[model samples]
Target: MTKYLISFEKGAMDHIPEADWPEVGKAARAVCDEAKDAGVFVFADGLRYDDGDVQHAVVDVDGVVTDGPYPESKELIGGVLIVDVPMREEALRWAAKTAAACRCAQDVRKFIDGPNNA
Candidate 1:
């Protein structure tokens, strides 16, 4: 099975009104339930915009811990789901379902295959 990282971009979610957040939450929950039933879902979730205050930590090259999102961008990673699937097509189908549930667009990408993939 392959693990795909599905992400939702920032701009696509601007339509949501703060007042209607609860309704959105309900929709998300329903989608999650359907995903669970479909057997195509391994895991899924939502996220907030900020990662709190940025902090620098240790780095491997210098034997130190590093802080902040690696390679930061204007749009923060809002949410994600690690899905185990047989093919990209299956993963994308679930991704589309998620996008519909959130009433927003989402980007889906595959996890790099490597020795540590185990």
Candidate 2:
């Protein structure tokens, strides 16, 4: 099996109306629950970026740490879902569900199979 990460960029849902957030949350959670029931969900969580608790940092090869996420980065990851599936097609299908539920675009990428990835 291969592990895939399905995620969305920060602020991808900024266009969603405030009042609709609750429904969006419900829809997203339902998708997660479905994945869990299917035994493909490895992990899922929304980053607490809006709450001021989430911070970013950057480290270089010299071990110098700087306030995170290079200034050039236009976006940060807002949420993450990891799934273990037999093929990339299944991962893409799951990402589609996530995008619809979250009202945002989703990206899917496979993890390298190794101790670091596992």
State model 1's lDDT. 0.74
What is the Å distance of residue 38 in model 2 from its true position?
A: 0.5
Give the alpha carbon lDDT tens digit for every residue of 30-96 in model 1.
8778767867567777665455766433367867676656555446667776677889998888788
Supply the global lDDT for candidate 2: 0.89
Tens digits of per-residue lDDT, candidate 2, 20-114, equal 99999999999999999999999999876545653777787999988754486456789999999999999999999999999999989899989
For candidate 1, list the clashing residue pairs, or say none.
Answer: 57-65, 57-66, 58-64, 58-65, 58-66, 59-64, 59-65
| Model 1, C-alpha of 76: deviation from truth (Å) | 2.1
Clashing pairs in 2: 57-68
- Measured by TM-score, how close is model 1 to the native structure? 0.71
Looking at model 2, residue 87 earns an lDDT score of 92
Can you tell me which runs of candidate 1 are displaced by over 4 Å?
50-75, 115-118
